[model samples]
Target: MTLRRLPDLTWEDVGALDLDRTVAILPVGATEAHGPHLPLDTDVTIAAAMAEAGGRRLSAHGLEAVLLDALQYTPAAFAASFPGTISIGGATLAALLTDLAASVQRAGIPTLAIANAHFDPTHLRALHTAVSAINAGGVLRAVFPDVTRRPWGGRLTAEFRSGACHAGQYEGSIVLARSPERVRGEVMRELDDNPVSLSAAIAEGAQDFVAAGGPQAYFGSPAAATAEEGHATIETLGDILSEAVIDALGTETWPRTKEQT
Candidate 1:
């Protein structure tokens, strides 16, 4: 079996898949503020690439998986103040995911896997809530490895924990890894480091980017980001993603057997 992209494949191609063993990966992202240097689709790019890597990992592990289109509009409460940052309401985001999950199940896909990159509190809550709703409906819930947790989180870079990684070294590095041209060299060189803990500010009732002490809508060492570190970060993210798929496959509830009454 090949690692296919759901959108690129024809209906006949999808029909040929072994539904019992196949899984659909749904990459989720938010078109939010990513500081001055990064684009609006930064989250989307990261999530989509990670999802593809995860799909490849599942294929390597002897299962079939495909990457689906990413959900771009997610809750962006923090970045919503910034111009060009588009955000959907939390409830709306949840409604969309719930509908997508149901749509996938009806297509005969055995299971739906969610791949995400955005770390906004509201965004995370919406994704989980949507998944919970789907799971409650008796549909096979997707595997969402909390990258913010141990093991996987530990696998990520140090800047991630500092909470100043928004468009900083952590994100900048991986963005460079994925697309070097997108990174502005002059901006990176001139930008001073802001090592403030965004989490701390948020704990103190900081809501938006400015309230978080980031007037420029950024934090951490953007200038220090290197392509080498970016590649390494991408690799680690891929490991986290693929591992989730493998682990989820072991516990899939697809082709659910009828309970013996």
Candidate 2:
């Protein structure tokens, strides 16, 4: 019933785990620009929070959740112009994901769940490719709850759904909740609203953050962010990840209950 950090455990501890009931949760993020208010590793912080919360939920449901070391370097071309943004090739990310999955499979873990917070187009495409490749190999099941689409996206806040939420309220709130010390509160409060939807701009052929209408590497309303809202959003993210993993396992061991929701 305890959630474990895989990196913190000894080889003996890992080897003794009931692998059949264990799910390794990988926190995937990007070292990219999130505006002047937030840190470059903003996505890394959010992904870690999601993974920890999801791992706790899985543990509550009688599953063994193992948290893996975060994958922080990812494709982040949109933020490439920013000073500290580290963008990698999408193919490199895909190959790394595949290799990680295969490594986990070899270590007796049957399921690998990704808790990803970065949503750059190239990064997302790489994730989809990696997930597909991992599943096709049949070595182990890889579950990715793509938060940008469908049911998952709908469950998030209005700012996030608006797609103008790079370093804005949506992401800023999470950073505030997880690492308040990193937020440049004075600058965040003075920033004007940039309601332009990055998604819509991308659809119109915009490539980077500037072309996407985020000259400051941000969009939406940053001043609107709150720690409470960030906590709520993190909880929702946890729900999305836990539900996806449970569904992927497809077992009747954990029955759904009204109270659980």
Evaluated at residue 172, the lDDT of candidate 1 is: 83
Model-by-model lDDT, in order?
0.80, 0.93
Clashing pairs in 2: none
Stretches off by above 4 angstroms in model 1 are 251-261
What's each prediction's TM-score?
Answer: 0.92, 0.97
Local distance difference test, candidate 2: 0.93
Regions of candidate 2 where Cα sits further than 4 Å from its true position: 254-261
Question: Please, what are the lDDT tens digits per residue for candidate 1 over residues 91-206?
Answer: 99999988888888887886788878888888888888987898788756577877766667877888988777788898888788888788776887789999988867877888
Candidate 1: lDDT over CA atoms?
0.80
Candidate 2: lDDT of 12?
Answer: 92
Candidate 1, residue 174: CA error in Å? 1.0
lDDT of 2 by residue, 109-200 (tens): 99999999999999999999999999998879999999999989999999999988888999999989999999999999999999999999
TM-score of 1: 0.92
Clashing pairs in 1: none
